[model samples]
Target: MATYVNPGSAQAGAHGTIYREVSPEQLAVEQQLVDNVVASFDACQDPRLQELMTSLVKHLHAFIREVRLTEEEWGTAIDFLTRAGHITDEVRQEFILLSDTLGASMQTINVNNQAYQGATEATVFGPFFVEDSPAIELGDDLAFGAPGEPCWVEGTVTDTDGTPLAGALIEVWEADEDGLYDVQYEAGKRAGRAHLFSAPDGGYRFWGLTPTPYPIPDDGPVGKMLDAVGR
Candidate 1:
């Protein structure tokens, strides 16, 4: 027989269980980890956190069991995540890109967001959006000397009832003709982005390059993963 102690853990039960473990008997039990964890939250302060943690534990554990994930595969996944973290910065969110590429981002939005009937639909925004963009007047060109096609856009904001909503603020940003956002340029050179307020009658207009389908950045770990998966 052997006795062991778990540092920082309090004693419990007749044998001083310390903290719960997947005992030999429990190994034969289905959903053992989920049961242990859900029962451990008796003192949980937040109801929502309890619900979230329990549900997450069950789903994540079930997924691992279903896949029978191997140790080597798990290690590779860890390496991928580590590189993704290293490559992320103030301007780049690799995790968001991961979610976006896997369609998880849109799927979550679809499940959570119910747009009002006749309301504008939402799409994935350009990752180049920077805060505190300079405001421009109607018809102002955001091109700002960036090489791109010249274009004009006009629109009016209105409620579901078709009544104009005045003084709506609008944010606009897009890639240049090269399909590179201003944030991706050297020294953070800004272009093809601006903000404007709608007119008293909810009318607005501006000049920007036409949108184009462009290849995503392929130099990071996430990009490599995408490439490996033939995305």
Candidate 2:
């Protein structure tokens, strides 16, 4: 039997019990499986893709082995993923909900967005953002007659050095006072969302609804999972 050295334990280094109790035969078997999976990526033409695949395989295998995952648990995971895929459509994305709930979306945002002087910090773009939204001029109402108290919104687009960025596109969306985005309605209404460009002086303005708190869509499989975990 091979001694599994729990990572991050006090026995993690050279002087640990792992050096004494390790079974080379068992370790070779596990390591060879990882190596074989990694080698399958050798013919990949893209070096970056190969690297990512290899690393993913290695880490995924390690996690499975470390957790001693059971077949039943694996099957459950597959079922969850299948349900997530089935519920995803143009408007509803269960996978994005899963990622957001698990904080993976935020972690990815943090990794990709580096802090630059005087620049806006990147945030989750969210799944509700749609393409080809109606374009409006400055001071136009973004509410599009959607229900809620009218709110005036304005901002300036500028470079890191505070120089104005003329004609910069600004897109904004929000839920109405009822705490629901345009996509949540059954009628497929469009409201509380629009895009506009900055003026030559980098100034822009529009009318929108006041922000309100809303719950994430919880009728899907991800919501069930969260509920199962008592989140």
Winning candidate number (TM-score): 2
- Cα lDDT of candidate 1 equals 0.76
Q: Indicate the TM-score of model 2.
A: 0.86
TM-score of each: 0.82, 0.86
Worst 10 residues of 1 by lDDT: 1-10
Candidate whose lDDT is highest: 2
Please give the lDDT score at residue 70 for candidate 1: 78
Q: What would the per-residue lDDT of candidate 2 be over residues 100-190, giving only the tens digit for each residue?
A: 8899998999999998887988988776777778899899999987889888888789999999999998988888888888988853578
User: Which segments of candidate 1 are over 4 A away from where they belong?
Assistant: 1-30
Report lDDT (CA) for all predictions: 0.76, 0.83
Evaluated at residue 100, the lDDT of candidate 2 is 89
